[model samples]
Target: MTKQQLFDDIEADEDWLTGLSTDIWENPEVALQEHDAAEALGDALREEGFSVEFGVAGIDTAFVARYGDEGPVVGTMGEFDALPGMSQAATAEPEPIEEGGPGHGCGHNLFGVGSLAGAIAVKRAIERGDVEGSVVYLGTPAEEVGAGKVYMIQDGAFDGLDAVVSWHPGWTNAPNKGSCLAVDTFSVRFEGESAHAAAAPEAGRSALDGVQLLGNGIEFMREHVADPVRIHYVVTDGGQAANVVPAEASMEVMVRAPDRAAVEAVSDRVRDAAEGAALMSGTEVDVTKTSGMYGVLPNHTLGDTILANMEAADFPLSEEQEAFAADLKETLGSPSYADVPADRRDEAAEAAMFTEPLDAPDEGTTGSYSTDSGDVSWTVPLGRFRAATWPAGTPAHSWQAVAAGKDLGTAGMLFAGKVVAGSLYDLLTENELLEEATAEFEERKGDREYESPLPADADPYELTDR
Candidate 1:
C-alpha cells in the first residue's frame, strides 16, 4: 500500500486509539508505578497480533512488543508516567480532579497511545505483505523521575534496532534537530553527632550545617562554570526539631550541561564541593550517583523525512477545538516566546494551535530540558519531533497543560501518529533514506562509544521513591 494508505489505516483505528488515550488520562500514575497503563497497552498490542514481552530489563512496568520476523527493525518508545502534584481537570481554569495527586501535565497520556498508533499501523502494513520489516513498540516507564530508558539500555534491551522514531507533546509542530542537556543526579547525606542546642552545643557537629554549606558552594560554583551549566538542589531532610543540632541530613542535587563530557566535568566539581562541605561542618558525607542520561544525538536525515510527511499530511481542527484552544490561550496572558528567534516571535504568538510545521534548527543547539530518550538517541539512529498538543504558550509540567490534555492533546496525538507511521513506511520501502541516516549516525559518532553513566547497583524504585 502507498504511504497515504498506511496513514489511512492508522486513522481507521482512531476510535480505539483515542479511547486508550482517554483511559490513560483519567488514571494518571507517577514514575515506575504505571501498572494500569502497562497492562492496557500490553493487552492492546496482543490483540493487534504483536508478541508482547513484559518486565523488560527487570523493571516491572517496562515492556516491548514486536511484529514481523525478518528484514530491517525499526522501533519507537512510549512513556506512560505522569508528573506528581499536577492533578488538574479538563478545563480552562485550575481545578484538580484529585487534589495534590498525579496528572498528565507533560501530555504523556497521549504520548504512549500516539506512538502505539504508529506501531500498530505499521504492523498492519507488514501483516498485509505491503512491507517486509519489523515494528517494535517499547513501553517505557518513569520518564518524569526515574529515567526508565537508561536502565533498559543498560540491560541491552534496545539492541538490534536499525533506527528509532518518536515524538513529544509540545506547543509547536517542529522536528527537533537540536540537542538536549545531559544531566547527572546525586543524593548527598551527612552524618554527625546530635546534641541539645542550649545544654551542650559544642558536642554536636551539625549535619544541617553541611547541607547549607553544600548549597552555598554550589551557588558560588555556578558563576565560575560555563553559561550552559545548571546546578540545582532541594533539602529533603534537615532535622527533627529546631532545638537539637541535626545528626543526619540529606539533599538531592542535579547537574546538567550541553553534553556528556561537560556534565562529567561539572559533576566532579560538585562532588568535591560535597566533600568540602563535610570537612567544614565536621560531618561525614555520603554521595551517591542516582542516574545520568546522555544528550540527544540528532539525525538530520530522519528528521527531514518526518518533516516531509508532516508537510504532506493535513491537520484540520474543528470549530469547537479551536474555541477551546482560544480559551486556554486567554488564561495564559502574553505567553513568553524568548526561546524562539526574534524574527519569529510575533508569528509564533499569533496561533493558538500551530498547524504548519517548522524546519529543524541548526545542529549543535541544545534545549533546556532532559529526558531518558536522549540515551536511546545515542544508542540508535533516532529521530524526534514535537506536535502542538497544548495551547500556544502553555508550559509543560503546569496545570494548563494538564487541562488541555484530554481533547486538544488527542488531536496532536493523531497528527503525530500519522507522521510517524508515514515516516516508518518510507524507511521500510526506500532503502536510501535509512542508509543516509546510518551514514550520518556513523559520522557524528566518530571515535566515540556509548556508555551508561548509571551505576550497576542503582535501583529505579529505590532512587525515585526516596
Candidate 2:
C-alpha cells in the first residue's frame, strides 16, 4: 500500500483511537501505577496478533509488544503517566473531574494510546506482507518524574533495537533535532537537637537555620555557575511547630545542565553548600542521590528521515479543532497569535503549525526543562517530533494544557501516531535506511557506552517516599 493509503487506514480508525485517548485521560493514573492503562493497550495489541510481553523491565507499568521476526527491529515508545494535581474533564473551561486528583496536564494519555494505534497499524501492514522486519512498541511510564525511560534502559529493554522513533503532543508539528539538559534530583536533610524555644533558646541548634543557610549559599552559587546551568529546589520538610526548635529539615534539589559533566560539576557545588550550611549551623547533614538522566544525543540520519516523513504526512486540523485551540489560546492570556515567531505568526493566524521548529527560539530552546527521553536517545538512533495539540504559547503542566488535551491534544496525537507508523513502515521495508541510521548511531556513540543515570541500588519507588 502507498504511504498515503496507510495513513488513511489509520485515520479511518479515528473514532476508536479517540475513545482510547478519552478513556486513558479520564483514568489519570500516576507513574508506576499505570497498570490499568498499560493492560488496556496490551489487550488491543494482542487482539491484533502481536506478541505481547508484560512486565518486561521489572517495572509493573512497562511492557513491549512486537510483530514479525526479521532484520531491522524498529521500536516506538509510548508514555501514559499524568501530572499531580490537574484533574480536569473534557471541557472547554477548566472543571476538575476529580477535585485535586491526577490529570493529563502533559498530554501523555493520548501519547500512549496514539503510539499504540501506530504500532498496531504497522503490525497489520507486516501481517499483510507489505513490510519486512519487526516493529516493537514500548510502554514507558513516569516520564513526568523524569526517570521512567532511564529505568527501562537500565533493565536492558532496548538492547537489540535498530532504530526508535517517537513523538510528543505539543503546540506545533516539527522534527526536533535539539538536545535536552541532563538532570539529577537529590535531597539534603539536616538534623539537630530540639529544645523548648521559650525555656532554652540558646541551648538548641536549629535545623531550620541550616536549611535556610543552604538556600542562601545556593543563591550565591547561582551567580557563579555556567551560563546555561539551572538549579532549583523545594523545601520538602521543615519544623512542625513554631515554638519548637526544629530537630530535622529536608530540601529536594534538581540540578540540570546541558551535558552530564556540567550537571555533575554543578551538583558537587550544591553538595558543598549543604555541607557548609551544616557546619555553620552546628547540625548534621545527610545527602541522598535520588535519580538522574543524560542529555539527548541528536542523530542527523534519523532526524532527517522523520522530518521527511512528517513533511509528507497529512495533518489537516478541523474547524472545530481550530476553534478549541483559539479558545485555549485566549485562556492562556497569550496573544491569539502571540508567541508564534514573527515569521510563523502569519501562518499561525492562518491556522498553520502553531510553533514550527524553523521558528523555534534557539538550538536548545527547551533547555529550561528536562525529560527522561534524553536517556533513550543516547542508546539508539532516536528521533522526536512535536505536533501542535494546544494553543500556540500554552506552557505545559497548566490548567490550559489540561483543557486543550481533550480535543486538540488528541488530534495531534493522531497526527503523531501516523508519523511514527509511516516511519517505522519505511524502516521495516527498507534495509538501507536502517543500516544508515545504525551507522549514524555508532558514529555519535564513539567510545562512550550507555550508562544508567540512576545510582546503583536506587529504587524507582523512592519517588513515592516524598
Maximum-TM-score candidate = 1
The reply for model 1, stretches above 4 Å from the true place, is: 338-343, 362-364
Give the number of colliding residue pairs in candidate 2. 2
Cα lDDT computed for each candidate against the true fold: 0.88, 0.80
Q: Can you write out model 1's per-residue Cα lDDT over 167-195, one digit (the tens) per residue?
A: 99988788889898999999899999999
Model 2 regions lying over 4 Å from their true place: 335-341, 349-366
- Clashing pairs for model 2 are 171-388, 172-388
lDDT of 2 by residue, 1-466 (tens): 8877668867998998888888888788888888888998888888888888877557788888888888678889999899888988766677888888999898888789778878878887888888777889999987887787888888888888888998887776777777888999887899998999889978889999999999999899989998889998889889999889999999988899987889988998889999999999999999887779888777666677776777777775788887777766666654454344567667765552373433233334545568888888888888777777777766778887887777778777877888888888888878788888888878878888877877756787776655
Candidate 1: Cα lDDT at 203: 99
Candidate 1: the clashing residue pairs are none
Clashes of each: 0, 2
Consecutive 10-residue window with the lowest summed lDDT within model 1: 355-364
